[model samples]
Target chain A: MKIDKQKFPDTDGFFGEYGGKFVPETLMYALEELEDTYSKLKDSEDFKKEFYADLSDFVGRPSPLYYADRLTKHYKSGKIWLKREDLNHTGAHKINNTVGQILLAKYMGKKRIIAETGAGQHGVATATVAARLGLECHIYMGAEDVKRQSLNVYRIKLLGAHVHAVDSGTATLKDALNEALRDWVTNVDDTYYIIGSVTGPHPYPMIVRDFNSVVGFELIDQSKALFGRMPDAIIACVGGGSNAMGAFYPFIDKKETRLIGVEAGGNGVSTGEHAAPLNDGSPGVLHGARSYLMQDEVGQVKDTKSVSAGLDYPGVGPEHSWLKDIGRAEYVAINDQEALDAFHTVTKLEGIMPALETAHAFAYLDHLPKDFDESTNIIVNVSGRGDKDINTVAEIDGIKF
Target chain B: MNRLRKKLDHLISIKEKALVAYLVAGDPDLDSTLDLMHLFVKSGVDIIEVGVPFTDPIAEGPIIQKAHDRALKNNISLPNIIKLVEDFRKVDDSTPIILMGYLNTFSFHKELIDKSDQHGVDAVLVVDIPGELSISSYGISNPNIDSISLISPTTSQERIEKIAKNGSGFIYYVTLRGVTGSSNLDVEEINSNIKKIRSYSDIPTLAGFGIKSNEDARLLSEYSDGIIVGSSIVDMITKQSESRNFDRIGEYLRGLKNAIL
Candidate 1:
């Protein structure tokens, strides 16, 4: 299983079992040509200048680290701050990775940016980047997800991406993933699979983290600017574990900032009603890499149920799994009802209607101790705006206000 | 000899092609599964592949999916599969029985696969797992049970060599690139792959995936050592089960006995 991980270059872009330049015997010459070009182009001053310039002006340079004073007041403890990724373009932290992948895609001379989305957030983010870059975009969505998340369907299409409704198998996220994989296998020549999360093969997690690490990069500066020091802890929600990874990566080197990952505890983790795979699962390989997974006793992956459609999954990102195993970060679960309660709590008490997915971190208040200090600045990644989830939440339970 | 080893070895020594039969365990009902299994062995089946239905069967065609849904609706559990195997052992013990399904369904039923030597199930064929990965590595820790692998016509010769070297019981060479039950095969490609497999290793190659009609089975029988028919037989039983003709399905299976032998 680890053999495949060994195929790639020793963190320098090798592909064999670690990773291969083994794209296709046909494209071998083209890829070799591209790699040679990339070596010279990668660290060129113009490349960095254009990339960082676009990131700040267009993609929203520095997402704020706003002190969530209300959460602190309610908990009657440590001061809480929210890294407002919700304020970024395309509504989630997905753009951070999408922006970088698109730039990398452009540098590779790839014409089409194809992606797979679960809750449709990543697809929209990728499509937004594709449109801005004047590249063709394709989004693969399971037919069932298309029906459930029709609004996201509209959002992706409005961004000018073609959505292929994956009707095979369970007609959900996994099927969408298979279709995306099929597309990659078929169109490897001209297409770049802009995976939304820090999952899929290799280079993806490493590169996506590099793009997303911007959050952690900004958090340190934001934390220092406001409190004259880095926060004691950083928290974020994990679907495929990208947003949490982005918020946690830079701080991984800084041992003081304890990292907490909140997975969607759908109905409940004990009830097997959540997508808290890392918390409840054991080590296994899926989508070409070893990671913690929600496999049945047969060791076959099982369907995970989470209140947040976004976090409902059977696997975790490889890096997140590694982090959990190494004890650098703690992966925890917050179930459907608890996330919903947190959603309402944050909305009413803090006037911020969090995405049902993001409310998982808010639900951590149940587990965290009540006493904290002003110096113990806690940063929670508000990964997305909740407008898209409002209607889905209303469909679940009726509310007057 | 082990049940799987005996079946393949028996056929190899006899200079006769093996006829491997397949059925979804607990389809329609558990009782019917037992009756169908017995009927399968009686009708010249050298070995049986008991399909353990799963929630997501990406490798299955429409026919098998329906059987899986019916089996799941009947509340078939992993224990039921073992119970079926145990019950089958009460009458007959010579015919090898291989438990075939997805890895999820198999992993949950590992205790059963572990006790397969005791229960008389000789091997397990998890349809979804590619040969590049091992059964034990995937958490199916039992060393006693043989892990059957499927090699498609689409699979490269190098891959065939790898699967053949590792595969025990028999090599299930899927006749088509598409899922089971789909028709219109390349008989030439089928024979070439089998010939290719023969060149690589001595593992007995069993052709399946689209072998439905007797003519189709008879045709594939010429190239491969064994034939496996799944969806067609399961579909026939399910169609008859709708009219409450459970016995008629068994009778119908009798008609296809010539297809295998």
Candidate 2:
């Protein structure tokens, strides 16, 4: 399972047949420029030095891999370790990518930064970096997201970034993405688009994944330093698969280690309301790449539902799709009830409030066998904090938060 | 020769600029789209473009996106769009027709590319697929159907030469560095780029994107061989739903045609 990075995504930015630049001709120049710049700078020692410096001082990288003692006892099977990405400056792993892209934008002399956010995590992250760099910033959010995640909208506004409410199809993350793409295509000259996840056309998926891979590399060293060995399995929630890819890429060549991606099974997969593209969708093109998408036969994107706005996307990252197709990774789904139960249980037992998206990963442990080898170790990526979802969870419980 | 090439050649022989009008199939409804096609011919449109509606059209602006939404609401698909062209062909056999859309619609059925002649489509312009990822190798280059390529303002000169060498029918030169339906046309830049592309190959180059006015069309036609008016025409068709009179669309087409010719 030795991953040959050099052989992937040949000159055209394809990972197998899944990823390509399917964007319009107007934005072709920007994508090509990004590709060339990333290729030149990705391996430079100076760039890495600067990136890691900010990751340490600004976004607080090398987040702890703490052992969840209570969760281990509850599961009664395997020892569980948590990769605490939630402790980052923005309370999510999204800062890892935004910080990298902002640096790239500054290096490219771009004066403006734009992004799309569903749960406001990416928007806050991008706005923070843009403010840090003193650049003009704009964020597109679906109107529905704006209503449900108003605190995030206020945070973005407080950071001096303009939040544009998109009232398009379904009024959600996909619509926000569509609007952000329009803005990028129209203002391609001065603006840098910082995609929030490992999705989109060529260069973006690769770029985001590269920026987030620090999580996996850190986890490898931290685990060996603490426990003297790599974990038996790694789990992360896959909403566009950025955080999961970040935590999984370094260990992909280690066949003995299991990479499990958990997706939202809202209601259930058979109910056709879930956002689990890897589980229920087919291969199609969406948002600029050919990936697994929830679409009708004639190729129109379908609406998706999930308790976590971050996971309510109809498509997944093309790299994840390629990985699933090749059997390099295993994907599973956790329903809303199970995830909510895990959210409450973990918060009470471990004294940590988990985001709904991250809860899906924790909930999967309940489904695993009640016993494992004594030496088995499992790592679960806690991608974000639960502060943003307090109102949502309270409303579901019929409490006035 | 394909009907598009023949029509362009005939227009060039007479020293006239070609006026291409674009309409979304099944917008408002299919019957009105048919009426608009015939009306385009009557208004002196040299060629007709039938845009197959898609859910995610990243390259299009508000006007075309709304048109696509309406078309989808009415259940427009590739087969139905081809049928609309077949119905249009029943009356007018001379005007060249092009099916314009994202690649997913055309790639959905391999036979759709093979049956272009039977469906009376002269050219296929898959907006998302660039020259390097040509579908011609996949049998889209059926002798009767010419596969089109696009050149944007940002396209490098070396890349233009390569795309032009492989392109057939016509090379669509995006007049602005923006999406369809966007404003701010720089006719001087368009003229210069078209001249540069013309130097690379013998294929005809047509200016499109943001050619909204008679002045815009007239100014752009002075540089390129023809002009393809999309958003402006589709915007007019969208207004027809309110006015319920399709004549204004023809009148606007005649105005654009008159300005160019």
Which is the leading candidate under DockQ?
2
What lDDT score is found at residue A41 in candidate 1?
58
lDDT of 2 by residue, A1-401 (tens): 56775466677777888878888777788898898888888889999899999999999878999999988988877889999999999899999999899989988999999999999999999999999999999999999989878888999999999999988788899999999999998889999999999999898998999899999999999989988988889999998999999998888787878899999999999999999999999888888888898987877788898988899899999889988988988999999999999999999999999989999999998877455654689999999998988888999999994
Candidate 2 clash pair list: A9-A14
What's the lDDT for all of these models?
0.75, 0.89
lDDT (Cα, tens digit) per residue for candidate 2, span B105-179:
777766876787888899888888766456675446577888888989888777888888888888999888777
- The TM-score of the first chain in every model comes to 0.90, 0.98
Q: Give the TM-score of candidate 2.
A: 0.98
